[model samples]
Target: MIHHHPDSNMMLEYASGSLNWAHSLVVSAHIQLCPKCAAQMKLLNGIGGTLLAASEPVTAAPTPADSFERLMARIEEDTDASPAAQQVGERQTTAARTRSRKAKRDPIFASVPPVVEKLLSTNPVLPWRRLSKGLKEARLTTGQNRHEVAFHRIAPGSKVAEHDHRGKEITMVLYGSFSDAEGVYSTGDFLVREPGEVHRPTATQNQECLCLSVVEAPVALTGFWGKLINPFLSIRPS
Candidate 1:
């Protein structure tokens, strides 16, 4: 069961169509696994549309610049750069093809879903080092944005430090379960926590867990390690 839906802020952004394509893709993927967030997103969409329609329309003077000219200039620039772009593009293409062949040769990765496979095709492995007891994590920077997402692997029977969040946090369980004060989350469960919420999350016995998490800012850790971890560990923004 998805105990905590995405926090109000993310849903609000989604309703207003403010999410970037890459992050939106992750949210959409989570929505597929979470009915609660799906429902909330739908509601936010309706509410936002209604609010917009309810407001009075205001007319403004059009800008003097010609949009067509701007588009034509951009197209011309792209055309001029196409050769160099193609060279880089070709190199990346060859690399991807080589990787695909390698993946096909690997038996363990053969059964991965095409969507996940396609997504991971270009993703390089992060510097996965141990964070705490039985836990390892790595951060991913989706392009040049301040927002960063992370992938976490928690060994079963392991517990993390009790900590408070600094911003919004969204978590989707891909495998196994993690428990906190609210409830336990199993595979496909989604949890969206608001800022200032505190919890010590621990995995259940028997198996390790895989989770995808996104944070806007960073979480505030409270111990001696927390001071050190705070500098390195990123969390969602408040």
Candidate 2:
């Protein structure tokens, strides 16, 4: 069960399509795993749809005949009407199903939602890079500014470097569990760390922990050793 979740305001922004793509992706993955958040998202979407329907539509100018014709022609061309296109679609679907089955067999990806699984499947053979002795990281490029999305894998009984956020940081536990000064978080927990919040997260002894993290700005490590490595630890926008 998920004890932590994105606040109501964040969920409302997600429902209204106001959040940046990276943040939205994290929230979407969480909603898929958390029934409470999923229900809340549905309620927010309903409210948004109602508000949109009740609002007056603004008058708009008509497009030129040539432009309208070109748009219609493009739409028609995109339709899958040919036998060859149907064959290609079938092959792609089969390949996707094969990948899905393989993912289910892998322990690391067994609990991941379809949203995150699709992203992970894009680079199935890529290896996780070592960030420290017991911590590894894999970056998920979303082509977004400021926000750095990645998977942080912590080995059993290992602690991440102590750090304070410069901006917002949202972390969703994808596997195992971890604890910090604030609290202990298990799978499906959504943790939001605002600016100036400092804590060191350590995975439990029994299993390794994997978390999906989205950071708006690079974190600043605290303490003497952390300060020494702070420059190299800064996670820049990709």
Candidate 3:
């Protein structure tokens, strides 16, 4: 049975596309694994659409002067530019925006299935990243890695060294359980460690543990050896 869940309140926020992207990713992973939340989400969507249909549409905003002309000119210019220039221009404009949009949409949980959102809300701490022995971490989302995601796998009896998150941290267990000095967490459990909090997590030998997690920025390790591995392990936003 699922132990933790995000209630209707949080679920609604997610369904309405209000939650953060990193948070939404955790929810997405959860929906992939859970079923109950999926049903709930469907209900929420129906309710939302009904509400929308019941309301009158708002007036459309007026187009700016020369907007259409400018758009046409830009299209013509794009067609005339050399391939190299077009590629560079595409990277500077379309590519950048596409990535930005995806990253922005990453946390909008409303689009995700219902069951996953509930499981994500199960543990509401930020999320944790494992840096090294006896050390774990929490990441915060500022403005990087718009689409990429990452997670950690801790062997039973294993711990990570100290570190700080560059962005939000959301973790959900795939198997087994783990605990820190704070409390014990088992399979199907979720943890969201907020930014700035630091703690080391250890898993029990009962079974191997898998966690689904996502972050918005890179993580910074504190120790000397850990810092050396930072570049290799550092996660950039998608």
Alpha-carbon runs more than 4 Å astray in model 3: 7-10, 20-22, 58-144, 220-233
Ranking by lDDT: 2, 1, 3
lDDT of 2 by residue, 1-238 (tens): 7899989888887787666667777888899999999999888889888998999998755433233234334434443234555687776776677566676555876768766766665546545799789899888754445678888999999999888898999999999999998899999999999999999999999899999998888888888976677777666563
How many clashing residue pairs are found in candidate 2? 0
Clashes of each: 10, 0, 34
TM-score of model 2 (CA atoms) = 0.81
Cα RMSD to the true fold for all candidates: 8.3, 6.7, 13.2
Model 2 pairs whose backbones collide? none
TM-score to native of every candidate shown: 0.62, 0.81, 0.54
Top candidate when judged by TM-score against the true structure: 2
Q: Pick the candidate with the highest lDDT.
A: 2
lDDT of 2: 0.79
Per-residue error for 238 in candidate 3, Å, reads 2.8
Worst 10 residues of 1 by lDDT: 63-72
RMSD of 2: 6.7
Q: Rank the candidates by TM-score, best first.
A: 2, 1, 3
Candidate 1 C-alpha lDDT tens digits along 1-238: 5555555776676556566433454566567667787788888878888998999998754321233234334434532335555687776776677567657542423433232333344454555779788888766544335456666888888987788888767777767788989889876666777788988889988878777777777778777878787888654311
